[model samples]
Target chain A: MVNDSELCEIILQYVKDEYLDEDDDTQIGPDSPLISSGIVDSFSMVSLKTFLERKYKISIPDAKATPEAFDSVNKIVALMKEFF
Target chain B: MAYADKIREAYRKELADIRTAGLFKEERFIHSPQAAEITVEFPSGAPQQAVINLCANNYLGLSSHPEVIRAAHEGLDSRGYGMSSVRFICGTQEIHKELERKLANFLRLDDAILYAACFDANGGVFEPFILTDQDVIIADRLVHASLVDGIRLSKALQESYKHNDMKHLERKLEEFQDKRIRLIVTDGVFSMDGDVAPLDVICALAEKYDAMVLLDDSHATGFMGRTGRGTHEMRGVLGKIDLITTTLGKGLGGASGGCVSGRAELVELCRQRARPYLFSNAIPPVVVAAANKVLELVSSTTERRDKLERNTLYWRKALTEAGLDIKAGESPIVPVMLYNAKLSQDVARDLYKEGIYVVGFFFPVVPKGAARIRTQLSASHETAHLDKAAAAFKKVGEKYGILGLKKDQIIAKFGA
Candidate 1:
């Protein structure tokens, strides 16, 4: 089973691969704002929730996947912990 | 009395907060008809300005067509005025029936039922069919707000996949395999980004999952495909969509009615049970006659839609070549991305000063950071109108220093 830091890294990598263009040089840290910063839009945020649910076999409630919860890797990891 | 005063104070503070956050929306009064050029009074009492309109839903530019206006006058003279009741009572007229028949034939569906508006059609469509908790509705994440509210009124389990992501939709279909009925609903074209749904692939997925598909083609009804049959025709999935709800308010003559055209049994079911259809007043006879004329025109020729396509191409190319960030799509809706809400508003306001009529979309209408000025093209727009609009956009874009900037750069500049 993946630990918290590993899960965070995995989510971060998934976001980077799916959302960011290859030429984009913007640095994304663990606590970097995603949704609020225009990095992850609402539709992309739903896709992220789907990815996490499918990968971890955990269903994140819609309420739990709010923009606030999905705004950062740290926050997402915290939200994921509830389901795990 | 004291409670009313407290409520008033609360609302006053809320409105003040909206203004403080630069999110207050102001309306523009249009003096002329909704066409390529319109006279507008901004901020209520300001002097009127004739601006090149880029924000209306008049896709085929039939909103103020002379033929359509004549048809409305004829309808008014013939059908009297109001229905005075709902369809179940006395609102159903001969012209209404004829329009419904013609619409179903045009849409290539078995039958159709009219509603007061597309919002009413959407709100009433789901509840009648998806009757049990065993059923499920899997929809695109970025569907219109009407669908959201409609889904909320249904008893079925509601789910959403990523927008236009076939793989994600397939996974959702896989996960919900045990559901009694899986209804997949999507807009024919997403208005914000001007992207068409991949209905061909969506239909295939629905077939594989043994599900049904419902399409809301409000944005693509009159000018999306080769023969103007909407996205289903454009995507080569004609007759595959189980249900289609569309508005007469947009591409279909810019009137005030909507309809649910679909399989015979489903439409009959809505006719019998859809609350909005059974209760709301029938569409005005004038609108019905005008819409009938519209369908007749679109059915005969592809002239207007073709012009719209060419105009869209020219406008999009012009904006892109002028170094503005434009969302790429096939529809006439062109979104000029301005990521920051205040930046979008400022750019739109400046463009208005340059005699271009447009509005900035921000949070609540769109996502918070995905703010944009959605510029729509019409067949009414001539080359001169498009040229002038593009030049105005370029001027305002330069004023905001947003020309040629990438998304990240824009965000970095404006704090999105």
Candidate 2:
């Protein structure tokens, strides 16, 4: 099972892999705002959810996937704690 | 500062943020009618130039059809310019009922109820019938904003499955079976990527779970399937779906109106209780007549749909061959992916200068990093029109050094 740090690293890596524009090179941290900072968007958020679900072997309820709950790496960690 | 001043400051800051994030929306003026070819003025409101229209929802090429225009004029003369009241309150016209009946017949459903627009039809459908707390609504996450709002007002326990993910839908259905009622809603064709929803699977899952299905076919109604019966027909799930809502503002003559077609019971209840129908003024008679005629055209001959299908297939092939990144789908909405938002905007602007009209989408509209220039094809576009549009895309993509970069390669190259 992936710990919070491992999950955060995986998420950051996945986001960098999937959601980077050619012009964008900003580094995202665990406490950095994801959705509000425009680092993750609606589409890529789904990718992140799927990635976390697959890697961590957990289900993310619809209520937990809202911007309020999954907007940052730290929040995602909190949500993971809620489920796993 | 006063509260009003603080409010203004908040609004100003939000607007500035949007601009800074490169997500501010700007509309272009069209000097001519919506068609496959149109004259659009510069954003500066300077002299307009003719360009092949590639962004309009005017599928099947009926928006400016001579017959539809003639019918509109005739309806205005025979019926009146407007209805001052809602359908039940002194606004019921024989033509309105006729259009509703024809729409129902076209979709092979028992009945259809007209709304001022499809947005209204979607808005008004849920709240009247469902006891908000007892009913559960499961929707595809990518459904139109109108449907999303409608579900919200319904007070139903709403859950969203991933867009077009049938497995997620099945899981959601299994979870919602304990609820008194289960309704699954989805768009027939997602307007952005143009990928069709998996309706056959949805119907199968709905049957297994004893749930009803609602399909918003606004993007597919006039040009999909063997007989243009919308997405249900295209996916061979016709006569299985419980409700279908569609717009006349698109493929059906590009006029302004919408309708919800379903079982007789649902239609009857919606007629009496749907707020948008009961409170809003009736659709104009001219638009009703034009929409009715458009239905006739689509139902009688498959010529227009056939042309549109050919155009879409050809354009998709051309773009694919040109090494541009596009979602591989049969629908006419072809999103040419340009990962960089600024690049997507620049490509759209350059394509416009090259006489092709399309719109660029960025973050907040679509997901971040999935920026694209969405291009829609109409049956009215000729060989020359499509060839020119494809050539313009190629020229622009080559100029920017942004072409053929697949999903995996996007971040590495553009992550800079």
Weakest lDDT window of 10 consecutive positions for candidate 2 chain B = B407-416
Query: Which 10 residues in a row give candidate 1 chain B its minimum summed lDDT?
Result: B154-163
> Mind giving the per-residue lDDT tens digits that candidate 2 earns over B18-117?
8886767777888888888889887866789899989989898888899999999999999989998888889989999999989999999999999999
Query: Per-residue CA lDDT of candidate 1, range A1-84, in tens?
Result: 679989989999988865676687878888999988777765457557766886798877767779998999999998888887
Error of 1 at B192 (Å): 0.4
- How far does residue B233 in candidate 2 sit from its true spot (Å)? 0.8
Q: What is the Cα-based lDDT of residue B252 in candidate 2?
A: 90
> Per-residue CA lDDT of candidate 1, range B28-136, in tens?
7889988888899988999999899999999999999999999999999999788999997888999999999999999999999999999999999998889985898
Give the top-scoring candidate (DockQ).
1
| Highest-scoring model, TM-score | 1
Against the true structure, candidate 1 has what lDDT? Answer: 0.89
lDDT of 1 at B62: 96
